[model samples]
Target: MRPTVHDIAAAAGVSLATVDRVLNQRPGVRRITREKVETAIREIGYVRDVAAANLAKGRTYPLVFILPASDNSFMHGLHAEIREAMIRSPSERTSIRTVEVAAFDPAALVTALEKLADERPAGIALVATDAPEVVAAVDRLVADGIPVVTLVSDLTGSRRHHYAGVDNIAAGRTAARLLGRFLGDAKGEVAVLAGSMLVRDHRERLEGFAALMAQEFPKLSILPVLEGRDDPELAHMLVADVLSKHERVIGVYSLGAGNRGLVRALKARASSRPLTVVAHELTVHTRAALIDGTIDAILNQNAGHEVRSAIRVLKAKADGLAVIDAQERIRLDIFLKDNLP
Candidate 1:
């Protein structure tokens, strides 16, 4: 039989009220008393059933998710996952609020975060922009005892509790290696498309791609990175213009969203031999392009998994519990034409 609070109190030679205070992490218990209760708990191997305890206390975590307001499939999918979680809120006992700010706007993101902080939610999960203002806001939240998790894109030099995203630099390196292998010994230029430099994910991917290209494939020249802002029309126009300007371009690496624009541009050049195209995210457009041999490879991060992981981490931090590191680690998924799921 498992030991109960009664056993813990008796073993610690403490009153039932003191045992409750220590167990629930309530204040007023002295350090020595708390240690005594903790020692007793360990001796009896008292494993807390968090689910049962939450149910008993009727505790519901209030969490906020801040996302970019871009018309990208990946963002839509993330919002969908958050909605799905809200549907299961009854059992999970979580109230989620989503706020969408202008994409790639550091000032706007900072303002949104400040407003959310005003409400003082239990936790906040956001796709952070790499800016001093944003970092300061995150640090403020941490100082105020509100746990914050950086999702998808991370903010450096901030007091964020956790980051629920893939290793973006590694993802970029993988994309570069795949492109190099696919276009072996090709003497042509490669065009890189990204959302914005403010985003850490896009910057890290560009860094990795540039590093690998310089080191492994020095023969191939890379064009200036075009900022599409993750907008479909912007990406399409930029890609078309770059293709026209650089006639020898034989490879394209899109390390951000806006594949719809890329698809249109590549399809327009159907008469020419297909370029070795690589992109991020396995969206509807990219998936179709892969099947039709338009995109050679895709490096993807599951936005659904990222959103859910952020929720779990925020909840665990709010409750002052240790999270299962392996469970919270998000993996980068690679997809090919043959494996279209």
Candidate 2:
């Protein structure tokens, strides 16, 4: 049988109220008394029943998730996942709300974070742009005791408690391996399209791709990175420009969202030259492109898994409970035309 508060109080020679105060970090307990209670708790291995505690406190963690307002299909998918989570939230004893802001706008994101912080929700989940002001805002929220988790993209130097996303470096390595092996000893220039260098995920993906190309596929040369800002129209224009300039380009890797533009660009240029394309995210456009031989492979991160992981971690942190590491792990999902889910 597990020991109760009464047993801990008796063992520490303290009143029940004193033990309660100490355990909950409430006021009115002396340091010595608190230490004695803690010692007793340690000796007895007393673990607080989080469910019971929350129930007693009538706590239902209100979580706020801030997502990018980009028209990219991937962001749309993430929004859908969050909506699904909201539908299932009641069963999990929590409530969730979302705020959408323009992508790649650090000032706008910071302003949104500030507003959310003012509301003082139990937790916050956001896709962070690698900006100093954004990081400072997240730090301020952490300092105020709000649990913040970075989703999709991370703020590495910030006080965000956890990042609920894939190791984009590994994802890039996987993409390179797939592209290199599929192309087999074929050598030609490879064009790289990225969302923006300001995003940590995009930067990491570029780094991994560069490392793999330099070490393993020295035969293939990487062209200057094209910034699409995860915009379909921008991606299309950039891809068209690259294709026009480099007729010898054999492959393309899009390490960002907005593959619709990529597909359009590839289809337009397919008649003149067949370029093997590898992109991130398995959206409808990319999936159809893969089926029609426009795209060779896709490196995807499950948005549903990311959203669920963030919610779980935020809830645990808000309740001061340790998170289950394995359960919170985000995995890279590989997709080929043959198998896509």
Score each candidate by Cα lDDT: 0.91, 0.91
For candidate 1, write residues 1-341 as lDDT tens digits: 98889999999999999998997899999999999999999999988777578879999999999999999888988899999989987888899989999999999999998998889998999999899999999999999999999999988789999999999999999999999999999888999999999899999999999999999998888999999999999999999998888888999999999899988999988677669999999988899999998898999998888988998999888877888999989998889998777
lDDT of 2 by residue, 198-275 (tens): 889999998999899889998899999999999999999999999999987998999999689988999999899878
Give the worst 10-residue stretch by lDDT in candidate 2: 50-59
Model 1 TM-score (2 dp): 0.92
RMSD of each: 2.8, 2.6
Q: Candidate 2, clashing residue pairs?
A: none
